[model samples]
Target chain A: MKRWIPVVLVYIALIAWLLFSVFPFSTTLLIALKPKNAFMKFPPDYFSMKLTFENFKIVLSDKNWIKYYTDTIIIATLSAALSVLVGSLAAYSFARYEFRSKEFLMVFILALQMIPAASVIIPIYSMFATMNLLDTFLILILVDSVSSIPLIIWLMRGYFSTIPKELEEAAFIDGCSGMKAFWAVTFPLAAPGIAASAIYAFVRAFNDYIMARTLAGDRVVTYTVGLTMFTNQYEGVDLTLVSAAAFTALIPILIMFAIFHKHFIIGLTGGALKD
Target chain B: MKKRKWIPILLIVPALALLIFVMMFPLGWAFVTGLKSMTLLDLMTGGGRFTGLKNYFKIFRDRLFYNSLRNSLIFVSISVIGQVFFGFLIALALKNKFVRFKSFFRGIFLLPWIASSVIVGYSWIYILDANLGFLPTLASVSPFLQMLGLNRKDWLTNPSIVIYVMSVINIWKGMPFSMLMQSAGLQSIPDTLYEAARVDGAGAWQRLTKITIPLMTPFILINLIMTTMITFNVYDVILVMTSGGPNHASEVLSLYVYNTGFTMGELGYASALSIILLLVNLLVTILYFMILRYRERRLA
Candidate 1:
């Protein structure tokens, strides 16, 4: 009876979580298919008397969406690639080398994670405006990469530290240069960790709003900022259209998670707890 | 090892340079901007004069600033505590052997966190919408509650309760992370420890208290600190949900800073607030490290 109590509680909690999480997604899907007038009924009809694909078609065919989606994809991909390359190198250095200010640098990098993006948004905006790079994809990529570097480094550093030094030492003994050893031996072994860090950087870049909103403005809107267009303060909000856009935005992330589930899980949770 | 000296330096240079140029420089610039008496025109045209601590003093005198800070602290505290408590409970349940389809449950549970905060905010807005919301409908439908004749509450409209509404959304989104960390911590403990306790006739509660709690301390501390930082820094959810509305009752520190700099065009005052947030985060980090060290020494 005592054991059964905990089991019952687990089921109860799972049901509660399901209602909270899945219910929203289902409601969103339902809303996306409903006619605009049906969305505002007094009882708020869940089922559309006549389902329509008009919202989806509109969102998909919009010219601005094409540019927004392309800009987001480019930014996410570039930031992920740059963060992985730079972060892996720095992680390897921290793992393999004993140098002056090593601890200080490590701590400093960790502390960088604490700096709120909001705090720097104004200065970053002004600085970018001065450089004439505001609203450029390059600025978005640079901002995303900078923000993601610390996380990638932390993950890579933790994973690299776990790998034995002797493997690289063996490569060095075989007349491989230090760079060659890292590339041929250490890096390949740390591929899983690298993949994990890359995916993380990608997700962060994709989901980020403040920097993208501040830097890109309307010129290079990301998926997050694009969704904001549906919300105007004084206008009548079409919940159906907004829901459709949100559902569409989630597809890429869900697909990415599906493709790299194991690596993503290990990378994210391992980095969080271990470090 | 001779070439190694420069190789490591070379490896670190690009990341360091990018970080400094993109992140660190802007932060430094914000500090400098805070010390200047710059109007938006002056800042835009590069004709600002120096004004030391004047913006900072102005923020202190502004009542909205204190309200934002207070709301931020309250929101963070409630969200963090709720996530951690529920997370611990979920972790305990997952550790049980009888739980079916564990991996499927874990994946679905993480949906709230993985979904964008803007999406979550909008979703909750639907769930809490006054005329067409689910919660009010459900509340009105319950036979037990209907018998009591309690009125359906307008959760979003009330300034005093909006933070709690926001907190619920945050906890739902964030609790999965703490659960994942705790589960990982749980996996690290050897089964033999539990076996020995069982052989010694210790009850399940005793084993949980004596073994699991102690082993999970490090993970709990890490999750707590990270959650606090996240809650404090959050803006997207608040932006989408309330935009610090109902007379700025739900306005958080970060959102306040954003508005000050961008909306009000008070660059200097916003910079000061940003600096304060940075210092607060730094202090929190230091405090966490100190506690960790103290725990390590006590254990030793």
Candidate 2:
């Protein structure tokens, strides 16, 4: 009985923290599942068993919502691919060779990573507006991809460093040119790191609200921006729709996280903490 | 190590060029824009005249600038401390031999961190809205909640405590990153140290303080700095929740910059505010690095 005290206490603490973490999600899920007008009722019926999929169905069938999602997918996917490709080249440069200003350049990139998006947002907005690039997928893609490059470079540099240089040398001996040796040998070996970096960039672009909002408009609405559109002035009328829309945006990312949690953590910490 | 000097440079040119176009050029333009007397309309017409140091001087006198600065300080400090503290506690708790299903607990804990700030903001709104909030709804029935004073309706609207509330939600959303960081730090500490401490009859608290905390200082400092920088820039949740309203009580520096630029059309002043923000970020970063260096020197 005495020994069980500590175990019980630990369980209680864990359960309490767990509840704190999960309560909001459960409540939101509940509200999202409620019938459209049910949430407006006094003393909401959260415990009621009258669940419905009407909200999800409505949101899914809406062409605007569908467009927002597809836009997000395209931008996120392309941004991820572009950042990884470009960032890996830089990462490979850092990993494979010692050059002049290498240390300075690496530190410079790290410092660049710390520049707040909000700080430069005004200039970015003006730059795009001046170039007539605002409201275009190309601008969002370029901006979002650039935002993730520094961290991805650092993360991928770490990955590239771990792969043996001997592998590339062996490929060199087998008549592979420098770039071919990289493509044939080191690239395959660094696939996991590339995947991790790509996903990191994808999530960053997908979750970017401020950048997407500032640079994008009607034709290029990401889900984050679209989620805000559901927030009409008449709060309750769109509350269910907003909730449903928000949840719909959440599912794919949640699924992605669940599938690649290890990569997600590595990416989230910017490779600062590796398991 | 390079036969051709240009090979590495060639490899790096694409990334460097993109960064220059996307990041560096914008930053340079921000400085130029900061010096001008411009608005959103001026931006379109390219008509702002240079007014050197005027916008900078104005920020020093702007009451709202000072207000947002104060709010940002409060928001960043509280969020950082709460996140690191709660994260460390949870990491330690999960490290215990008695804790089971560790990964399951960790995954659930990370949900808030993974979800978009917009979603997180709306979810919390649903939970805290004055009329239809989950807490108020639950409070109507539960005597325990009412006793605990969790029945308040102005959780998002009350100016006085709104910043603090935002800090709490920020903690919920951010603690997992610190947890993962601290967990990695914890793992790096050899188990033999704990075993030796136990052999010496040192209790749990002493073992933690003497062994764990001492070795974990560097990790904690890094965690602190990272969280500080991240939280300083975090206005997304705030944007979605209150839009820095209920009389601008919750507007941090980043959000204030956004509001000033886009909402009020004060593009020039906002550009100046952004430079100030960039300085604040740099100041905090340099301060932490100095502390880090000083600590390393002492340890050495």
Candidate 3:
């Protein structure tokens, strides 16, 4: 009975806490769905207010909205794929083979994760402009890929380290060349890890604002870049319209996270927490 | 089967090339640019006058830079503490098997972590707006808020408490992540240790303080490093929320850099300030690793 009391108390507290945590997300949805009139009313009735998708309709109807989503999608997909392709092989190399300056190289790469894009925006902009690479899909993709590689490398390295050495030994004993053995056996086994890395890369690239703001232009703007233009108006911020745009921009990543929820946990934890 | 000498180097080159082009080269260029007077036009023209360390001297003397640095340290410290405290509680609560729908709860908690900062900024702004804000709505309904005079309070606009408000929002945004990390750490603790403590007449509080805290130190270190860095570098929230206004009350280092570079058009000065930001981050990373290595040595 005493133990049951503690458990019940904990549960109640947790329920309240969880509600508090998710209230903002709920606010986003509610505000996003409300028409402009509801927003204008003094002391806006957040709940039981009439809901409408007029905001979404307006946002979706914009010509740049389609460009925004497609550009973001293209950059995100390439960044994830390129990071996985480049990062995993590096991970395998770090896990399996050791060479000169390996320690130095690993440290250098990890330190790169701490360098914010804003810190180097001046130079990157100059260089990109020099090559006519600014506002291009390739520039955005390359930036995203470069930024994502360090974390993905660490994650894939952790995953590679966990796979038992004996599996690779078995393949080697079966007369498989090193590359063949990796491609045929180890690669298949690392699919979950690859998925996790890809998801992380996708999320990281998708959420980037600094890179997009600096490097992107009128034609190459990502959704997040476009979302900020809502508040940049001369008169005042249109909260309802901005909320809708923000929520609309959030939908794809939310769906991605929902579909790969378990992998997100595994990937994130595996990267940082795995022994 | 063959451990080729060149294989590892080959694997590293392609990633290295892209990384150098996008990250390393630009950082190096930033250092050079910081030594000169640069403008938007000078971006491609290489026309900035070479004025060695003049930008660094000016930025160091700027009052806005000082306020931003001070604000960043204060905000980051509060954020790390608040998030970790709440996160530990949430992780402990969720780890209990008696909690039903654990996975559902986990997914819900991930919302703040995975959502774009731009959206989060907007969502918070919608809720915290002084006129039609959720708080004021509660205030209009509940006498408790009126007692404290929180009715229609300008949370983002009030410069004095604005830092605290920003800290709270960032703490909420970062809590789910530390919760996730702490949950992983809590699960990895073997049940036998707790059972042994129980056999020794340890209370729940005693067991947590004596056993759990000691073992959870490593994950807590990781949490500290991550939350500190992210909180320090937070830009978009302040960018959207208050634009670091009514004055420069809420401006952190990252936002200050953007304002100085773009809004004020002082790229060289911004570069110098960011170099300091990088130095601070490097110090923190070094500090975390040193503590970890010390712990390892002690254990051995």
Highest-scoring model, TM-score: 2
- Best candidate per DockQ, number? 2
Q: lDDT by residue for model 3 over A96-125, one digit each (tens)? A: 787999999898887787787657766677
For each candidate, what is chain B's TM-score? 0.93, 0.97, 0.94
Model 2's lDDT to the true fold? 0.89
Writing each residue's lDDT as its tens digit, candidate 3 over B179-287 gives 8889878979999999999999999889889999989988888888878877777777778788788699899888888888777877777777778777877788788
Best by lDDT: 2
Give the interface-residue alpha carbon RMSD of model 2.
Answer: 1.3
The TM-score obtained by chain A of candidate 3 when compared with the true chain A? 0.86
Give lDDT tens digits, candidate 2, residues B1-300.
346998888888999899889888889998998999999999878889899999999999999998999999999999999999989989888899877898889889998988888888989999998778888878888899989988788899899999999999999999999999999999899999999999999977799899999999899998999899888889999998999988999998999999999999888888999999999999989988899899989989
Q: In angstroms, give how far residue A23 of model 1 lies from its true place.
A: 2.8
For candidate 1, give the docking quality class from DockQ.
medium
Give the range of the ten consecutive residues with the poorest summed lDDT in model 3 chain A.
A229-238
Model 1: which residue pairs collide? Answer: none
* Candidate ranking (DockQ, best to worst): 2, 1, 3
For residues B52-85, could you state the per-residue lDDT of candidate 1 as single tens digits?
A: 8888898779898889889888999999998988
Off by over 4 Å in 2: B1-3
Among all windows of ten consecutive residues in candidate 3 chain B, which has the lowest summed lDDT? B39-48
Candidate 1 residue spans exceeding 4 A from truth: A47-54, A169-180, A233-237, A270-275, B137-153
